[model samples]
Target: MHSWPTTTLPELPDTPARREPVRMFDPSRQAVVALTEPGQQRASMYVCGITPYDATHLGHAATYVGFDVLNRTWRDMGLEVRYASNVTDVDDPLLERANATGVDWRELAAQQTALYARDMTALEVIAPDFYVAATESIPAVVEAVEYLLVHNLAYRVPVSETVPAPLTPGAADIYADIQAIASFGEISHLDAAAMTKLFATRGGDPDRPGKRDALDPLLWRAARAGEPHWPGSGLGDGRPGWHIECAVIARGTLGDAFDLQGGGRDLVFPHHEMSTAHTSALEGRARDLAPAGARHHTHMGLVAYRGEKMSKSLGNLVLVSRLLESGYEPAAIRVALFNHRLHQDWEWFDTDMQAAAQRVAWWRTALSGYGGADPLVFLDEARLALRDNLDTPRALAAMDAWATRTLELARDGDDGVAGAAGLVSRGLTALLGIML
Candidate 1:
């Protein structure tokens, strides 16, 4: 039996009135709104993790950074947060990468996952409370699928060579009752035509012979020759599909219902939408049980390079490892990413990094001699900005102003300036996850 994390996290200051309200963009609501109820003391988050092949690119960094900010803000507000994320160590991309390199898929997953951990640590992302991997949670995944099958929410379909060439090889089981979830297309906001196109493009086998609906996603993929496989109770030797891994892991780590579910904008469709459906189906049958529903569903904007979206396929990825190799500080990389709204798509440029580096240098110099003071005092502007839908650019602007004022005061020989500057330094660490 997989159990929720038992390790305790340190509690922070609990000044409810002093903490600023936190608002975030909700794709489900299609508007910015308060993310938590007033005076709520605990929060939980689940963000989709990477597949660990060509891992830790700028796009990945930005997505993780966006959620990291939310987690930090929640904890800084004195809310205990249970954050769970998955490492998709046994996905198609990992298999394909391993096959191409003639490396054992498991070895490749382990190696790349270690590299991903290093990148995230260097970027100063707070470690998730529960960092579950699909391979390790295979038993949980299989059990969840069996539940869905017994409830009639999912069915096993036969696969044959005559299936469309684009369909995933050996995919056999699918979630059948997609219509059960109300507002299904509202989250992604995709029309029939666009959703259909993206579904086919993003691993959806819309035209699979026995599927009831075009949008139905594979729940279990029967094992094929040369593919990684696991034995299900009665589902045969195959790996779980992309969407089910997260659903199972989230339930095991953070209970069925959690406060937040987040991922990159690209996942709003088949990935997030389908995952929500599967979880909802599970809740329907297990009526006496807790429902795995996210109060807010959020997505970070895609990071692009040279007028194209950063992706492994486009070969336009601005990898974090490469950037570190080129001598760019992780702090600067994070600041550059914070330059845009978390929900707005933007292109990455060399100039952005240069500007962020300069900002970091200025802040470091400004706060150099600063000692200790209440970090919350210098955080008004930053706090208010962040409270407003995680307005990072505005928070950064506030930080710039804080830096300027502190430097001016210090130049004028103000006695309290050093302490104030120190507060600003600590506030940056708390609010922005940046160490000055």
Candidate 2:
């Protein structure tokens, strides 16, 4: 059986310097920041999951594996970590695809979620402690929506019989009002005027009546004919909006303000932005929330294809299952990804995969008769590099140098060579989920 991390929680560190900061990229800050905490060695994290319509792909692997490494590293350092990842089981894509495929929406969701779990296991990404489904969290979602409505952050709008025309300057005032309190531009790294232009082109209209702002996303989207709808909510018969599921799930699982939040860079805009806004707004209303005043740190990894961004809609996509089927080892794929810094995008190429495979082979050969070494020296070096804002690429380069030296020592029959190889393998395994 594959060994898993022991569930016994570690004792909290006594000093701030001893405790690792839960550092992550904050979409709000548009830069990585150390998460503010209520106590030492306690950190909470939430990452949005797939919508269940698309099959798991290289892009999905890159994201989950990246964060899984972070989670493992944090825990290995003796921190108490509670990780939550949500499944967006209900959404417009699911409904439309279900209709086109003539499959039940729930069945589709279940099958896809199961596939995702299997893929994660195959890649050795740790399963999150809380694996929630949006459909199961409907009550929590409704509660959040109700809270927003009460605070005037969200408002219900009647379906317009006639599509609204172009927004005038007066209509722009409504959008501006929501922007003032929402911090919408901050999370997206866009100025207010830039955000307005982008939103307008993406179907948001400032002139729409009953909407507090054109950019104010729907908390509860009224269900249309032939669409999936939840019945329990005080909001009329409709499914939760794409952004609301995350806020509700985070609030329910991680409380008001958790330690770290992360996902693909693509989600930095409307998705993470909305989640941050909603959660912050909710906290402003409740004085007793567990993390009522805590700050959230966010981080995102890069995207790449064959040295380019992988976009299925553009036919440049790569699937994890296909890569495996084509004889790429899971470990090699992961190592190649880790060679790139987690926060920056790098291209995916066969050469990169081959280089990772070469590293694995060299280490395995170098360590053939190796006994364990005191890994702390090498681990400390790697750890220091990682702690400097997760500089994984530089850490990997250090590993490469260490591996090269160890191989040379093995050639000379040095006793420490085997031990050094063992250290390298263990460090890579623990830090990147890459097993030689």
Candidate 3:
């Protein structure tokens, strides 16, 4: 799959490499923990990608940009980062949207995925090292599923009416036996009852008979009529399930046990939880979750509009592409999103864009002027803030203070002041992901 254009990260002034380790909230541990081990200089991340049915909304932008901050933070700290993300190009939602709009599913996925790539480019998000689509990983998916089956970690049940897949005359749908995996619920921290409730609403069949446990997620869906299908296992033509697709893709590209498993808070439950379970199951670990071990998961809060969480089902989307087309600078839109912390869920107002645009204008103007204060101090503050739980609000505050000081104390014939301004501009680009 073709990915978005990569933004060239501007280099900071040559100095000693930064040594701060990033600390983020890990749901499993219920505490803020350092991402890197002692003396570790390499990191990996696997953020779940968009389904691409609806494409780059503000909610979508918030998640990717939030992770982009993490990417920038790790690099600024002199860590080698290997990142992977996926596109659910073949799914029920994608096919349903295509059928409703009278377009082929393949063309729809391609067009929307391309648009998502463009939006990420506009937002200056660093591209993932591996941007896999579910359709592209059938062989790996089949291999992973087979591993579980051979290990007796997964089982087969009758193909049901809920699945779009056609019944394999004698073969049943495959599922990961959650009962067999002792660590299934470790990631979400949700009790069995809570997991069941969420699973039913978020694509689980708790009432389905013959499931080893009510929470067992589908491993592979059998071949269906008028929908995408691939040869998955001996059960006949099928497609991989949501959780399994992520497990294979992340493990395939990033290797086993990576640093982070990140996405929106909505994914905290069955999606992240079950995927982590699948990953652990494949590796023969009976009681572990995620490639990053415990506290390895992070999630951005949902973006809300009109007192409701922004979603395609709600029909109240504020798209990033539309905002850019309406004359808002991409950097300004980024500033608008960054005004809040990663896990802070807040509602959007039109004033958000207005304030961010003004902020961008002021920063641009300040960066081009001269000042006596050393800009590197605030640059350090910016890095510290981001390292501490990806604190975008505090990081932006540091940027604002530097910009104010720069413009307020401009002086003539001072090469020192002129050099300070240039250094501060580069600092913002490298530390805060602001190109100004």
Which of the two candidates, 2 or 3, achieves a greater TM-score against the reference?
3
- Clashing residue pairs in candidate 3, if any? 166-223, 166-224, 257-291, 258-291
Tens digit per residue, CA lDDT, model 2, 327-425: 888887887777777776767775777788887676567556564333455566666666666777766776666666666665676656235555567
Regions of candidate 2 where Cα sits further than 4 Å from its true position? 1-24, 30-32, 36-39, 161-184, 197-210, 285-294, 306-308, 371-374, 417-421
Native-to-model Cα distance after best TM-score fit, residue 305 in candidate 2, in Å: 2.2
Weakest lDDT window of 10 consecutive positions for candidate 1: 1-10
lDDT of 1 at 314: 89
Ranking of predictions according to TM-score: 3, 1, 2
Rank candidates, lDDT, best first: 3, 1, 2
- Give the Cα error of residue 347 in candidate 3, in Å: 1.5
**Which pairs of residues collide in model 1?**
256-292
State the lDDT at 402 in candidate 3.
76
In terms of TM-score, how similar is model 2 to the real structure? 0.84
Could you give candidate 3's per-residue lDDT for residues 218-273 as a string of tens digits?
98877876777887646578888998999899889888778899999989999998
* Model 3 ranges off by over 4 Å: 14-17, 160-167, 287-295, 370-372, 411-416
For candidate 3, give the lDDT.
0.82
